[model samples]
Target: MPDYKAPLRDVRFLIDEVFDFAGGYQALGATDASPDMVSAILEEGAKFCEQVLAPLNRSGDEEGCHFDNGVVTTPKGFKEAYAQYVEGGWNGVSADPEYGGQGLPPSLGLLVSEMIGASNCSWGMYPGLTRGAMAAIHAHGTAEQKNAYLPRMTAGTWTGTMCLTEPHCGTDLGIIKTRAVPNADGSYAISGTKIFISAGEHDMSENIIHLVLAKLPDAPAGTKGISLFIVPKFTLDAAGEAGARNAVSCGSIEHKMGIKASATCVMNFDGATGYLIGEANKGLACMFTMMNHARLGTGMQGLCLGETSYQGAVKYARDRLQMRALTGPKAPDKPADPIIVHPDVRRMLLTMKAFNEGNRALAYFTAQLLDVEHLAESAEEREQAANLLAFLTPICKAFMTETGLEATNLGMQVFGGHGFIREWGMEQLVRDCRIAPIYEGTNGIQALDLLGRKVLGSQGKLLMGFTKLVHKLCQEHAEHPQLKAQVAQLAALNKQWGELTQKVGMAAMKNPDEVGAAAVDYLMFSGYITLGYFWLRMALVAQQKLEAGNGEADFYQAKLATADFYFARLLPRAAAHKAAVEAGGESLMRLSAEQFAL
Candidate 1:
């Protein structure tokens, strides 16, 4: 009834055929993640997503979450499902083995997470936050801190929350009012009120570990002064289990437009016992370790919702008997032909399909870079992957969400009247997805990070790291029989991407506002080109398979068709972005505050 199914076939296509994740895993010495193991995980992950998680998505949204006094209760079945998730060892698949994880590569974890998100994004938030928290502790926490938290957190008996935003600050961490004061016994007392803390308080786990950002007494003026703290809901006993209640409590939970089942809390930390992570005045850097992972995860939220939308729309389009096709009735046996007969409907369906599949390929490729960055032997290889990861991350977060939002809207459009209805479940997805662009360092901030910090800040070294790969792909496929034109289109766009960055970089030097003005459009241009590169590469693989008479001709043909649709329709949007970048910032900044009101 939920109409959600995991696209394991497509996952297999991306991992096996398109990205060669098997080879990638082996190359990275991830012998534990063999082809058989990967396949089994995919199959099992799909089953859990479809049977266990998908059914609860609608119920979770309708019931939302409950807050009583300071206690938060998730929607019915959420706790049970989480129990199954932890029991199945899904929590530790890609976490560190030292901390009870299976020590799998991070990319495989992402592949499973895609299924989890598609089936139940609201449910996914619980473990999702936990994983981000684990990464922060793993990277920056002390050995004692790791021993205290990582094992249980990875085991999923306890969960985690990233508490940074206050009622006052969302993006500006430097201006935070929360303060940390030293106590006699080497710990600190943290007092702060953090708002919009997802999974801030919940009943599903025994204890909650909060990674809070607060400034010390003698800290510097801005962001550099901020420090990271490990604040727990309940103090740990000698057994290291949750013992006495800490000073932290849920002040209230937000009544959100969506993801309501996941409690986004207003946490009140009244002089809670806290342990410092990394160093004093160095919390923001420590938090970025978690945020980068979150940004990628948040990007996949777009894909998850979009993929579900496509499945529902496709089913509806096939079964719903609408007006006869303009050409004629393809199904004359029925009173009217299905809307799938219509060109307009086909256009909508293809757009959703192309964006969903293309975005999947893009996410998968970027995910693999994580394994390379972490596990590769060569320092040069690791650095290259890291550079590419940094450059692509903002795009992954911003671009995927932007296009994915578009895809969800198109899914609703395909269903027409029914899309707005609750039972159809399309509208709920739109409501849920509405937040992805705004949160996780908003798409606008992501754009600025891409243009200002990652690209221009590196003096284009980081941008070149990615563009060189684009150039290589272009050169390799310059003469392909089927994809030559598409490759040429991609090649030209890749060249222009560099030129436009240089143009923006030059203008930004003259007027610092140029970066802000051109950032979103610049990022969009870059995203379009990035997805185009991936799509073109997918087309090449699909074409080669078709030529060689490989498995599932229909599947391969559909892939080629989607890639063609992407090139023909989606990639041209880059031109408009390029034009906007060239248009400069004058128009954007023209209206004085007083004049705007007049």
Candidate 2:
């Protein structure tokens, strides 16, 4: 039993004060997006998550997804919950109004996504995958495809999935063996076996659209030869109704350790009726449009998992009576003192809170940049915003996920032995958070993309631009007392990252092996610096609110304390990662074949 509350106050503070969502909405021509409307949406979403989703999390994990023969059944309450979820218009929170969407900001959708993930990540995947698929179709599909698919997808009548990973290939798409043949009827016949497809085949929606990657016959080798095809489980009639059953079938469902509620199907598309999306030879490029969004969404999973675990740990620590404090028992008359009385316990709880809050700020900050990149009017302004957002995307995905796992682990630690038990639900958070680093191109790949393509390719333009934003913020700290130390630490860390990034870039040219050797460490190091910047902004906001003697005094005070803990404990890890990167690539690559055999 975990009682989860969405952090609405903090969300509002970020929306109103930090980034000005109202201004963004107006600039994007969304005049209806008033603060009151946004608040109402979040309140309703919070209720659904806390009441409906949170209660079923443990039960769903216990029940798991049921696969009998070829049909897949989601955990109990999932079907009914999904119906209710769609009825509430939750699926299309940020979709285009022309296609049944509410036309809200993607930032609002992201905020709701955080709550959904916090309550039940397993359940969230069903809709999460659908959104990702919709992004692909909406971006690259033809007008007919948009009319037929986008509406239902927005309404959640049809769920969706991305079929990319196969048994032989997960990251390298060029060598994939799946084939797509052009049919005389202006469609393609797709034949492929896809593995690790989340929400690949589920008995929840009316139809499941799979945007699969397969190579056309007469195509070049590797990534350039791959093409994207929209293959549905049931073929649609001329009127866009479910027509006859298609050849697409589920071979089996993966029996995973976590997210047992969302079915991971091994899909087999045998001569399936398929339509081309975007250009035939340019499939990888089209799919990447969806992947960029997917990567960020996956990162949020870590944040959500961390938030849920933190709430559960806090509830348990307050209720569970245990040994007395080291200095003196806070509850002298009681039979046993609450675990919160111990300094060590406080440290564990504070660590989780600090990381979770910092991550929240990071998600919101990156989301605001997304708004600027998409909606800004001027080309100069848009390019500047896009550059900053692009630079932070990998950091947001890699760092949030890495720290999210750390925060969840801290949550488990706070519960001590109770966390390891199945009944407590702490172990589930740990398991669910573990996959974020592995998915959306393992964190190692993310690092190389950041250092090799984004940083070095631009000759440090993106990195330096981000540095300028930090400098501007630091200059603002002259008037604020609380953020002085945090700002200094961030400045130092950014300088180290800047110098190390330049060195890594230059070394990578001389020997490409050097990039692979230090990619993960560099990614993690940058993640720390970015999150530190977020915490500093949060501390500044919290300090301002507390000074006003607002009603949320305790909440604001807690925010400041957590910010201090992040600077002292978490931000320093980046320095060591930088040192490790500078130690030369030989430490990672110099081992002989015989030595590696052991």
Candidate 3:
């Protein structure tokens, strides 16, 4: 079993030292949560995650969620664990206080998210999706809708899902066949088959509220005509309580590669009781409210999985005796020296550490931006914060997930074949982390969104703004000897990527094909650069703390070393992505229809 202790020191280092969440939240006056309050909440949340959810990880993956006769059953203990989760008031973190939420900063919610996700992603998805659903309703739904649904969702007696994908369509929501018809009672009747709906059907909650995207009868063709609807599994009575069972039913659940414990349902809504959310014929806009939240959360999942895997790997490496050191036998009297004595093994461990710590800093910083965008006093500040996150989200989601996959792979490598086996748990980490990049929109789509929408469409304003932030960080931390070289490297590379983005954007305007061809490559390059910046910031902080005479001198020193490994080994990946993007449309566009055929 993994040590599974909350990386409180590192978490604090990121929240306090790197991003300064308390100060950020205080600036917004969003919450009166003090340092002690934040510490107590994190500690208890970590305890719950480590004790209640961590143990279920392997069991959930092994047993998987079951679907029989239009009903889905989660792995054993999921319901009980979920009860504890709601009881702890976790579902309402950063939610509206008027609706029973804690009204905490998004940063604090992000902290809890990491703990729970690292402990058990499968169990985490249930509440995770519900909170996302609540956010969407709160943001876009009418006052009546909020009154009817927000309280129950905040309380976790009800769960929520985003129902967008169909059997034939995933990313191309414009072509979806789902339909919503208006009723005389002002409710819409939604009839659609939604596939891959996480938390769609589960026994953990009394009702499942689906934020569905469908087209009306007189709607125009494509995405513009679509509308967002809140379709509940059970109809609420006049008293606003879950009452009659609606027409929504789980057709089946997916047999997926990972996250098996979270129910992914194929839902059939035959005239399900539904209400419109936000404007008519603007479903995509409303769905973006939830999708963006899910995107960031998925990235955090990637980061958490990597963190736990690293912790597990470090614990195992120190205890398990392996081959003697290459330099000298550190434990000559014994049969073998611990693997930690070996330089190559140290490299693997360092790689995980560097990626995990950088990801933690990045995730929390992004969360702080979420608070700033919503609660910042000035309109200019809000716009800046929102734009910063807009460009950062795809990078956060794509980059963190991409690094997480690599980090977990390194963790598995550290354990040798033991990591490949089920009993050791590293294998499960890899499996769970793998899905993060694919879902919440594939990293490829994220890349296109970044280059096309985030970068090119806006004439690189958002991208440049984020680049300026990175430049400022580099310049501020320029005096830190340990990080100065890497900081310089990151700044130089970022400038190069920025220049390249401008050139590509200009050329892409003349040729539409170039944008699609370069999207993934551009996204991957940007992701690497973003993570490189994060690693540099973390390295600087680790170096400063190491000089401050911390008792955990060894840990801080190791953090600096890992940051070096990231810049040396991982950041080089940007070269390949850049090369591909610079290839322009020729290579990709040259492939004829017959070339792809047999």
Candidate 4:
């Protein structure tokens, strides 16, 4: 197993250099998140992740979680690691200050989260789900609900879970059968079974707060009738301490291919006490507040796994001897040259590096938008940021995970037979990363959301909002001597992205299936272009640093090189996606469901 190291340098580069998070913080009134404060937080976050979480990753995977009756116990060392995580105050780094949180910007929390996730994804899920639940409650919960639940959750005394999926329903929530009935005290009895609930039942925290979705008695049919509720595993006493065990119980824990240590439970809420959140029949809207947060975090998982895989692959490539380089013997004294000397190995390494770095930039940029959306002073600014986020969220979730899976697979491929062996730990990454694209509304669902709802649903305004940012960047750098070429490339792609959306919109008008067929490809295409813009920005920054005779010439030069590789090798992928998107829905729909089988 390879050791996980936080990419602190690259993280700092993005936070300090590329994104200007300090300036963003100032604008957002996050006066406490100064550069010095942010640096200290990141450094401390890195130490905890590296020292505490990384060691348990493989062991956790091996041990998995043990389930007995209704109780779920996490793998050995997980409880201890989680204790240390809470001790370090990592859980509420970005929660509302009014709720016992550190009250840092969401982006900073995401930065720390990236490290935690890469170090130990299974352990990270415990708190990751909590953050999502907290977001939902904070956004939609009543004052009493927030005051009662937020503090314990922010204090890390209790963990939270979003219980949406059931044995029957996955994405199509309108057909869900979960039922909630009002009680004498105005609370509701939530009775349903939710499956695939991560952190649903665990001994790591004192209590589990579940954000549930169900239907009220007089509810209208379909999605409009759904309502959100907060159902705890153990109902709180008058003193706000967990007292009587609620009707909620873990039916069983799932045995999975990867991320086994993260308890995926089948939670049975049988007349459990639940409090309504937001409007009576607006549960889906409230749940989306959590889902969007989870979706972005899920997208980050791709980058986290990719980063860990890349680190392992790079280490192995540098040390593992293999056939000599094609040109000549690079390691003359050794039996054979290290695999890093080979062209194919270099290709794999570069591909992993390109995606990892490019995705980081994209994630951080979106994180900044999240800050603006939450804290900006002006309504217009917040609205603009919200519009951009709405457009980018699906792309970020789908593209990053798809590319992340690619990067992790390439990492394993670079290892040959050794990669398949579990002891080497490469295969575990592949298994762990596989679920990212499948969950969080699946990449297919995300594609439809992106193209159908966000892009075409708005008549291309949402997309244009993002393209405008790209155009502005291009215009700013068009006159620069060294960056002119990259600027022009981004400019052309920006124009083409809009045109492609229009073409797809026209085809979708003729046949609605056209949207579904072209959605994923369209998203991937947009992702390539989006990353292309970020890579160019990074390259331009590196170019400036080089011109200024910076001491970190190697780092800057590598950034420029990766940018070049991304454009030359990866950006062309967009062309293929575009071709498929232009192919329309005919070929895809022609195949009968039965024909998909052997």
Candidate 5:
């Protein structure tokens, strides 16, 4: 079995050394998030994840979720763990205090979430969706709606889901067949089938609040007609408690390759009782409040699974006796040296390490922006944070997942044949990670959103929000003694990023297909440069700490080493993405639709 240990050291290094979460919280006047409180939360949260959830990962995957009739049952030990989760006051760590939350900063909440997710991705899904649902309702729900749902959901007794995907549509919400008919009581009858609903129907929570999207009778056609509705599994009575069974039912659950314990259900809403949360025909925009959160969380899935795989693989490599090193046998007494002595194995391990640590830096940096966006007192600070968040979100969701997939695959490779076995647990990480790139909007969709909607949609304004930071950092540290070369490399890459975007923009103006063709590559290119920026930041921090003679010498040294590996071995991949972006859409489109057929 893979022993999943919390990477608290790394988490702290980023929170304390890299991004300085402590100082930021102080700046935001988050009195409860003192350094001691932060440490206590990290330690306690790690204990819950490592002890409560980690042990259930393999067993849960083996047991999966059970579906009988219209009900769904999560894997064994999940409910108890969930109860412990709520009792421990973890459900609303960063929620509004008005709704029973601790009112902690967003980054702290995200750090806690990382520990939970890294421990058990499947178990995390239940509460994870609840978080997205909570965000949606909190943002769009009226006062009554908040009073009706927020407390219980925040307490973790009630879970929530966003039911958007239908049998015929996934990304295109405009063509959805779901309908909302008005009733006398001011409620609407939501009748539609929603497929791939994560946490849609589960026994873990008392009620499942589904934020469904449907078109009203007088609504306009296409996406503009869509309206958001709150359809609960169990409707509330006058007392606002879960009372009677609603019309929603779990038709079935998916048996999948990964995250089998998570119930991905096919839901049938036969005129389910639903209340409008936002203005009519504005559902898509409101739902984005949840979608963006999910996208970021989904990106964390990649990091979470990759962390699990890397942990498992590292242990296996160090302990598992393999062929002697090519140069010399490091373990002279043993039959063969440990695989860690081998170059190829080291390469695989380093790649996993580089991506995992680099991605963590990116995530924590984004979390810092999230904190500013939510808690900053100044309007200017909030606006800049929002812009940067808007720009980096797609990159976070897409880039992290893409590289996370690579990390997990590399981790599996390091284990060789043992990695393929079920009991070893390496394969499960890969399976769980496979979905990150596909769901929460596919990386391709994220690419288009980055290049098409966010970049072009904002006319380069959003892109500049982030690049300006990169330029300023490069200019300030032009002679970064230890990382002068890295600084120059990043500066050049930052310049090329804007140049390539401009080229694509020019081409897209002439032929719109240019944007489509360049999008995925452009996003990848953007991810590499973005990650490069974080890696540089980390490297600089490590250098400063080393110069200042801070303790934990080995840890800081490893950070420097990994930063070096990223710059030398990984960052160059950005060039290929740039070349693909420059290749244009003609070569891709010249082939006729008939040529696609075998």
Candidate 6:
């Protein structure tokens, strides 16, 4: 297994050069997050992840988490590493200052999160889920609730989880049978079983705060009846410290294909005391606040795993000698040429490179939007940022993860037979990444959300808003000699994206199933073009640096080369998706459920 290293250069490139995040921070009134401060934070974050988390990754996978008699024990070193993470105040990097947080921009937190996730995804889960829970409480919880939970949670002395899935329900929360009965003390008694709860019962924290979803009595049926509740594993005393154990207990932990170190538990709530969050019958909306946060984090998991796998693949390719380069002997002194000398190996490496870098840009861009949404001074600015976020969230979640899976598999393929073995740790990445596309809402559901709700539901306004940005970029660089061709490509795609949406919208209006059929393909198409815009932006910047004779010539040149490879090799795949979107729903629906079998 290769040592996991954070791609600090690429991260800094996106934040400092491509995105102008420093200027963004100043504009957003995040004065504390000056460029120096941000850089320091990133450097410190990199150290913690590299030194503490990376070493635990394989050991965590091998040992997994232990669950016996409702007690959950994390893999070796996890508790101590988490302690260091807490002591460093990593968990509350972006939480509200009133709750003992650093009060930095969420984007800065996301930057650090990407590094931690890449080093050890399983170990990251404990705090990752906590952040999601914090978002929910911050967004929807009452002031008293926030005071009771946020401080300790933000301190990382306590961890949190979102409990929504039941034994019979996953995505369809409308039919959830969990009951939240109103108690005499105004608290609710939550009773039912929640399944697939990540970090649900870990022993690394003083308490586990669960934001549970249950239906209140006399509430409307289906999703409309659902209400959110704060159910802690241990009931808190009047002093706001963990007290008696709650009725909630881990029934069992799942034996999973990967991420075995992260406990996926079946939680049984037997009249667990829970405080209602938000208004009754509006729990789904509140849950989405956390869900969206989790979705973006989940998307980054794709990039994280892909990056780790890419690092391993690149090292192996450079060291593992097989045959001579097609052109000539690149490593003449060796027994044979290194595999990295081969064109196919280079192709695989570049493919992984393009996706990893492109996805990083997308993630960071979305993070900027999040900063704007939360901290923008004006209502219009906030609303505009929110609209764009709504439009891109599904795309980022689905496309990045879908492509992330491809990138990880490519990493394995680059390793050939050795990749399949567990010792190499390449297969671990493949196994771990498999669940990303499935969880946090399946990619299929994300596609439908993108095409059906966000795109057409808004009458193409959301789609237009993003294309307008792309259009502006093209317009700005249209006259540049070096960037003209790339700008032209983006302009063409910008126009085509609008046209494609219009076509899909028109078809779906007549036959709604058309949206379902074209959804995934349309999303992939959008993703490719979306990435194309970022690649061009990066290339334009790299070209400027080169023209100025920047000292980091290799870095800028590589950026330009990767952008060229993306445009020449990867971006063209959008055409196939365009064709598939135009194929309509007939072929998909014609095959009935019975025809799916052999």
lDDT of 4 by residue, 1-598 (tens): 7799999999988988898999999988999999899989988999998998999999999999999999899999999888888888888888898999988999989999999989998999999999999999999999999999999999898999999998988999987888999999999998989999999999999999999999999999999999999998889899999999999999999999899999999999889999999999999889999999999999999999999999999999999999888999999999999999898999999999999999999999999999999998999999999999999999889999999999999999999999999999999999999999999799999999999999999998999998998999999888889778778888998999999999998888888989999999999999999999999889988998899997899999999999988988999888999999998889988888999995
TM-score-wise, the better of 2 and 4 is 4
Per-model TM-score, in order, reads 0.99, 0.97, 0.97, 0.99, 0.99, 0.99
Residue lDDT tens for model 1, 177-242: 998999998899999899999999999999999999999999999998999999999999999889
Model 6 scores worst on lDDT over the 10 consecutive residues at 481-490
Superposed by TM-score, candidate 2 places the C-alpha of residue 209 at a distance from the truth, in angstroms, of 0.5
Cα RMSD of predicted structure 6: 1.0
- Per-residue lDDT value at 503 in model 6: 91
Tens-digit lDDT track of model 5 for 473-535: 999999977899999999999999889989999999999999999999999999999999999
Worst 10 residues of 1 by lDDT: 1-10
Better of 3 and 6 by TM-score: 6
Q: lDDT of each structure?
A: 0.92, 0.86, 0.87, 0.93, 0.92, 0.93
Candidate 3, TM-score vs. the true structure?
0.97
Lowest lDDT block of 10, candidate 5: 106-115
Measured on C-alpha atoms, candidate 5 has an lDDT of 0.92
Query: What TM-score would candidate 6 get against the native?
Result: 0.99
Model 4 scores worst on lDDT over the 10 consecutive residues at: 480-489
User: How many collisions between residues are there in candidate 5?
Assistant: 0
